[model samples]
Target: LLIMFFTTGSFADKIGPTDGNIVGRETDTVTLKFSYETSNEYILLYWYKQDTKSTPQFLLYKSARSANSERKPTDTRLESTTTRDSTELTIRGLKLSDSALYHCALR
Candidate 1:
Protein backbone atom coordinates (compact mmCIF):
# COMPACT_ATOMS: atom_id res chain seq x y z
CA LEU A 1 0.00 0.00 0.00
CA LEU A 2 1.02 3.60 -0.62
CA ILE A 3 1.13 6.00 2.30
CA MET A 4 0.85 9.67 1.47
CA PHE A 5 2.77 11.92 3.80
CA PHE A 6 2.87 15.67 3.74
CA THR A 7 6.07 17.48 3.01
CA THR A 8 7.19 20.94 3.82
CA GLY A 9 5.11 23.89 2.60
CA SER A 10 2.09 21.66 1.78
CA PHE A 11 3.59 19.19 -0.63
CA ALA A 12 2.90 15.49 -0.29
CA ASP A 13 4.56 12.27 -1.39
CA LYS A 14 3.70 8.59 -1.26
CA ILE A 15 5.75 6.01 0.58
CA GLY A 16 5.50 2.27 0.09
CA PRO A 17 4.79 -0.36 2.70
CA THR A 18 7.43 -2.73 4.07
CA ASP A 19 5.47 -5.93 3.31
CA GLY A 20 2.03 -7.35 2.55
CA ASN A 21 0.42 -9.24 5.41
CA ILE A 22 1.07 -10.13 9.04
CA VAL A 23 0.20 -13.65 10.20
CA GLY A 24 -1.22 -14.15 13.68
CA ARG A 25 -3.18 -16.59 15.78
CA GLU A 26 -6.13 -16.09 18.08
CA THR A 27 -5.28 -14.31 21.37
CA ASP A 28 -1.79 -13.66 20.08
CA THR A 29 -0.29 -10.23 19.72
CA VAL A 30 1.08 -9.18 16.36
CA THR A 31 3.07 -6.26 15.14
CA LEU A 32 2.96 -4.67 11.70
CA LYS A 33 6.10 -2.77 10.91
CA PHE A 34 6.61 0.01 8.36
CA SER A 35 9.89 1.47 7.19
CA TYR A 36 10.12 4.84 5.52
CA GLU A 37 12.57 7.68 5.19
CA THR A 38 11.88 11.20 6.23
CA SER A 39 13.76 14.46 6.47
CA ASN A 40 14.27 16.54 9.61
CA GLU A 41 10.71 17.67 9.81
CA TYR A 42 7.76 17.16 12.06
CA ILE A 43 5.83 14.02 11.16
CA LEU A 44 2.50 12.58 12.20
CA LEU A 45 2.06 8.85 12.09
CA TYR A 46 -1.25 7.06 11.61
CA TRP A 47 -2.46 3.45 11.78
CA TYR A 48 -5.62 1.92 10.33
CA LYS A 49 -7.14 -1.43 9.50
CA GLN A 50 -9.44 -2.19 6.58
CA ASP A 51 -11.61 -5.29 6.72
CA THR A 52 -12.19 -7.18 3.49
CA LYS A 53 -13.47 -4.43 1.18
CA SER A 54 -14.38 -1.83 3.74
CA THR A 55 -12.80 1.57 4.28
CA PRO A 56 -9.65 2.00 6.35
CA GLN A 57 -10.68 2.22 9.98
CA PHE A 58 -8.74 4.58 12.20
CA LEU A 59 -6.62 3.04 14.93
CA LEU A 60 -4.33 5.70 16.37
CA TYR A 61 -1.73 8.37 15.63
CA LYS A 62 1.25 10.02 17.34
CA SER A 63 3.55 12.90 16.66
CA ALA A 64 7.28 12.75 16.28
CA ARG A 65 7.86 14.41 19.63
CA SER A 66 4.78 13.56 21.66
CA ALA A 67 4.46 10.28 23.49
CA ASN A 68 0.67 10.56 23.66
CA SER A 69 -1.45 9.03 20.90
CA GLU A 70 -5.09 9.06 19.85
CA ARG A 71 -7.38 6.18 18.93
CA LYS A 72 -10.81 5.78 17.42
CA PRO A 73 -13.91 4.67 19.26
CA THR A 74 -13.59 1.13 18.00
CA ASP A 75 -9.86 0.93 18.41
CA THR A 76 -9.57 -0.80 21.72
CA ARG A 77 -6.63 -3.05 21.10
CA LEU A 78 -4.49 -0.99 18.74
CA GLU A 79 -1.40 0.96 19.71
CA SER A 80 1.48 2.54 17.82
CA THR A 81 5.13 3.39 18.36
CA THR A 82 7.97 4.68 16.20
CA THR A 83 11.68 4.52 15.86
CA ARG A 84 14.08 6.68 13.90
CA ASP A 85 13.23 5.03 10.58
CA SER A 86 10.30 2.74 11.27
CA THR A 87 6.80 2.65 12.74
CA GLU A 88 5.07 -0.29 14.38
CA LEU A 89 1.46 -1.12 15.07
CA THR A 90 0.96 -3.58 17.90
CA ILE A 91 -2.36 -5.38 18.11
CA ARG A 92 -3.28 -7.27 21.23
CA GLY A 93 -5.57 -10.31 21.57
CA LEU A 94 -5.88 -11.24 17.94
CA LYS A 95 -9.08 -12.79 16.58
CA LEU A 96 -10.14 -14.37 13.30
CA SER A 97 -11.86 -11.20 12.26
CA ASP A 98 -8.61 -9.33 12.77
CA SER A 99 -7.52 -10.59 9.43
CA ALA A 100 -7.62 -7.61 7.15
CA LEU A 101 -5.54 -5.05 5.26
CA TYR A 102 -3.60 -2.84 7.59
CA HIS A 103 -2.24 0.54 6.56
CA CYS A 104 -0.04 3.30 7.94
CA ALA A 105 -0.13 6.96 7.01
CA LEU A 106 2.32 9.75 7.70
CA ARG A 107 2.03 13.49 7.57
Candidate 2:
Protein backbone atom coordinates (compact mmCIF):
# COMPACT_ATOMS: atom_id res chain seq x y z
CA LEU A 1 0.00 0.00 0.00
CA LEU A 2 1.09 3.54 -0.71
CA ILE A 3 0.05 6.80 0.86
CA MET A 4 0.34 10.29 -0.43
CA PHE A 5 -0.10 13.81 0.91
CA PHE A 6 -1.21 16.95 -0.77
CA THR A 7 -0.23 20.51 -0.01
CA THR A 8 -1.21 23.96 -1.16
CA GLY A 9 0.59 27.25 -1.54
CA SER A 10 -0.64 29.92 0.83
CA PHE A 11 0.80 32.91 2.64
CA ALA A 12 -0.26 35.64 5.06
CA ASP A 13 0.82 39.23 5.44
CA LYS A 14 0.37 41.35 8.52
CA ILE A 15 -1.54 44.39 7.42
CA GLY A 16 -1.84 46.13 10.79
CA PRO A 17 -0.09 46.19 14.11
CA THR A 18 3.14 45.40 12.34
CA ASP A 19 4.89 48.09 14.33
CA GLY A 20 4.56 45.83 17.35
CA ASN A 21 3.99 48.89 19.41
CA ILE A 22 0.71 48.39 21.19
CA VAL A 23 -0.42 51.54 22.96
CA GLY A 24 -3.20 50.90 25.48
CA ARG A 25 -3.89 49.90 29.04
CA GLU A 26 -4.60 46.36 30.05
CA THR A 27 -8.29 47.21 30.28
CA ASP A 28 -8.23 48.62 26.79
CA THR A 29 -8.56 46.64 23.57
CA VAL A 30 -6.19 46.32 20.63
CA THR A 31 -6.99 45.46 17.04
CA LEU A 32 -4.73 43.74 14.51
CA LYS A 33 -5.12 43.25 10.75
CA PHE A 34 -3.92 40.37 8.56
CA SER A 35 -4.15 39.34 4.90
CA TYR A 36 -3.81 35.96 3.27
CA GLU A 37 -3.40 34.52 -0.24
CA THR A 38 -4.12 30.99 -1.35
CA SER A 39 -4.67 28.96 -4.48
CA ASN A 40 -8.46 29.15 -4.34
CA GLU A 41 -8.44 26.77 -1.43
CA TYR A 42 -10.09 26.87 1.93
CA ILE A 43 -8.41 29.19 4.44
CA LEU A 44 -8.19 29.09 8.19
CA LEU A 45 -7.27 31.94 10.50
CA TYR A 46 -5.77 31.54 13.94
CA TRP A 47 -4.05 33.62 16.63
CA TYR A 48 -1.54 32.67 19.27
CA LYS A 49 0.78 34.01 21.94
CA GLN A 50 4.45 33.16 22.09
CA ASP A 51 5.47 31.26 25.17
CA THR A 52 8.85 30.82 26.82
CA LYS A 53 9.59 28.33 24.08
CA SER A 54 9.59 29.05 20.37
CA THR A 55 6.00 27.91 19.96
CA PRO A 56 2.61 29.55 20.00
CA GLN A 57 -0.16 28.25 22.22
CA PHE A 58 -3.99 28.18 21.93
CA LEU A 59 -6.37 29.32 19.23
CA LEU A 60 -7.55 32.88 19.88
CA TYR A 61 -9.83 32.90 16.81
CA LYS A 62 -10.71 31.04 13.58
CA SER A 63 -12.83 31.38 10.41
CA ALA A 64 -13.80 29.32 7.37
CA ARG A 65 -14.28 30.02 3.65
CA SER A 66 -17.97 29.09 3.53
CA ALA A 67 -20.63 31.30 5.00
CA ASN A 68 -22.79 28.35 5.92
CA SER A 69 -20.00 26.90 7.99
CA GLU A 70 -20.27 27.60 11.67
CA ARG A 71 -18.20 30.59 12.68
CA LYS A 72 -15.82 30.28 15.56
CA PRO A 73 -17.03 32.17 18.56
CA THR A 74 -14.72 35.01 19.56
CA ASP A 75 -13.43 34.90 23.07
CA THR A 76 -14.57 37.54 25.52
CA ARG A 77 -11.03 38.87 25.41
CA LEU A 78 -10.84 38.78 21.63
CA GLU A 79 -13.01 39.49 18.57
CA SER A 80 -12.63 39.05 14.82
CA THR A 81 -13.97 41.03 11.86
CA THR A 82 -13.62 39.95 8.26
CA THR A 83 -14.54 41.21 4.79
CA ARG A 84 -16.15 39.52 1.80
CA ASP A 85 -12.77 38.87 0.18
CA SER A 86 -10.09 39.48 2.82
CA THR A 87 -9.83 38.36 6.44
CA GLU A 88 -9.47 40.76 9.34
CA LEU A 89 -8.92 39.65 12.94
CA THR A 90 -9.70 42.11 15.70
CA ILE A 91 -8.65 41.26 19.21
CA ARG A 92 -10.42 42.79 22.17
CA GLY A 93 -9.59 43.25 25.88
CA LEU A 94 -5.91 43.23 25.15
CA LYS A 95 -4.28 40.77 27.47
CA LEU A 96 -0.82 39.30 27.78
CA SER A 97 -1.90 36.43 25.51
CA ASP A 98 -3.00 38.97 22.93
CA SER A 99 0.61 40.09 22.66
CA ALA A 100 2.62 38.14 20.18
CA LEU A 101 3.57 37.81 16.53
CA TYR A 102 0.07 37.11 15.20
CA HIS A 103 -0.02 35.12 12.01
CA CYS A 104 -2.75 34.21 9.46
CA ALA A 105 -2.29 30.84 7.85
CA LEU A 106 -4.26 29.36 4.94
CA ARG A 107 -4.98 25.66 5.00
Q: After superposition, how far is residue 29 of candidate 2 from its true place, in Å?
A: 1.2
Predicted candidate 2 versus true structure: per-residue lDDT over 20-105, tens digit per residue: 44455565655655454444434455555454455654445455465323245446555666553455555565565444554544
Q: On a 0 to 100 scale, what is the lDDT of residue 19 in model 2?
A: 34
Candidate 1: C-alpha lDDT: 0.64
Per-model TM-score versus the true fold: 0.73, 0.58
TM-score of model 1 vs. true structure: 0.73
lDDT of 1 by residue, 14-33 (tens): 44456555676788898777
Give candidate 2's TM-score: 0.58
Highest lDDT against the true fold, candidate: 1
